[model samples]
Target: MCIENKYPHAETTRIENTLGQRPKMFEIDMLVPNGDAFEIKWRDATTDGDHITKEHTRLKVIANAGYHPIRVMFYYPQREQARRIQKTLETLYAGVGGHYYFGDSAWQYVRDYTEVDLLAVLNRIASEKTHGE
Candidate 1:
């Protein structure tokens, strides 16, 4: 809803999943026409190897659809396996000419792209809630 409000033209596009026996559609987080296809995650601590393959395929699909794939993960995992998976994902993103941002960089990217100080706004809301409570 924030994306729709901020970027009136931004859309959440669906891609059909042909790999599974049952047909399904994968939702791309947010896409701006002639711009970036964003895959956003609050945190991804997936240690599953399949996750990597799935992400790789998703990136390819975005690229094939004529959009630059960009990943924004606000939190980086602490576990060793999860960190390794994150690293692999970072490499995959770079391999396909996509950009990956994590931690502070992720927040900065959102602020830069949306021209809004999202973190500050969130902090203000949090402060208000704490004080009101």
Candidate 2:
């Protein structure tokens, strides 16, 4: 919502996925037209090892479409398995010349890219809820 509100032109893009046996389409999150592809995640706690491969394939598809792939994960996983997966994903992103932002960096990326202070907005919402405004 924030991205759409800030950049009304930003839209989800569908790309062909040839990694699977049968070609299908993959919907990318918040793809800015003629700009980088942004994949925003609130959290990734998946311990499944296959997740890394899936992400790699998705990144390749995004890049193949001539867009730089950028991943922004707001929350860092606490579990060991999940952490390993994140670490692996981070490495994969780097290997593919993609950008990965986790935790504070992720928030900063959103703020800088969108020119919006997400923390301040979130705080205001919290205050409104508390005061029943």
Candidate 3:
């Protein structure tokens, strides 16, 4: 989902000075409803330094705000790179509850599966303040 915010009464001076009339700060490619966020890089995988850097920055901001943030790098139409990214995400979030999947299917299966819906699982976890069966 794309969220667009028009300039109304919120810091036109700063926006003009920093962005020089650019309308977008950043485009969030995909947001998983359970709170995991992702930015996709489909092609031109050779030039992903900027994308990865920005994704980590966003993740840090969200984490500092006390929310779980996950960065998913998608190399769509490139199966080899996608698999590599999948492995990386799995290893990175191995022991963390909020870090799994990051909206990707391959790494998602690395975690244990319950027959419950995501919300149900999340609610149970929240109530218990713990993960695992």
Candidate 4:
């Protein structure tokens, strides 16, 4: 794992917290030496998946290990799916002592306030699509 330039002095590490007695280890996405960790959930992370059962344990392992883990859930363009996942993710993240973040795109999650101009972004994307056409 590489040290993030912002956290240069902090070594990055990965932890394998097994999903169950079956010995399936779920790898943590990222962790910093200074006790900051991040675990990501991709598209359609509704509570119905097989791995969903083990998510709480995974988060507990990270937090119990002394890191302030954050759970970032990716967003979908589809409104219903996105809303469902966002609601579920927020509920889980709160239960496990981690921060919850979700966005229409990854940029929205990381950007500081006042920089999220969705209209401008959509317009630029539309213009690019026109070029391809």
* Candidate 1 lDDT for residue 30: 91
What tens digits encode model 1's per-residue C-alpha lDDT throughout 1-133?
A: 4456668898988877555533366678998765688899989979699888888877776777677989999889889999999999999999889999999999998888887777888899999999994
Candidate 1 runs further than 4 Å off: 1-6, 17-24
Q: What is the TM-score of each candidate against the true structure?
A: 0.89, 0.90, 0.34, 0.60
lDDT of each: 0.83, 0.84, 0.39, 0.59
Taking the tens digit of each residue's C-alpha lDDT, what string does model 2 give over 1-133? 6677778999988888966743388778988865778888899877696777788888887777788888999999999999999998898888778899999999898898888878789989999999999
Better of 2 and 4 by lDDT: 2
- Rank by lDDT, highest first: 2, 1, 4, 3
Candidate 4 lDDT tens digits, 1-133:
1224445555435666644463345465666656767665565535454445566677777777677877655554366754665666567768867787666544465333224554466679999899874
Candidate 3 at residue 22, lDDT?
31
Candidate 1 vs candidate 3: the lDDT winner is: 1
Q: Higher-TM-score candidate among 1 and 3?
A: 1
Lowest summed lDDT over 10 consecutive residues: which window, candidate 4? 110-119
* Candidate 2 residue runs with Cα over 4 Å from true position: none
Ranking by TM-score: 2, 1, 4, 3
Per-residue error (Å), model 2, residue 41:
0.7
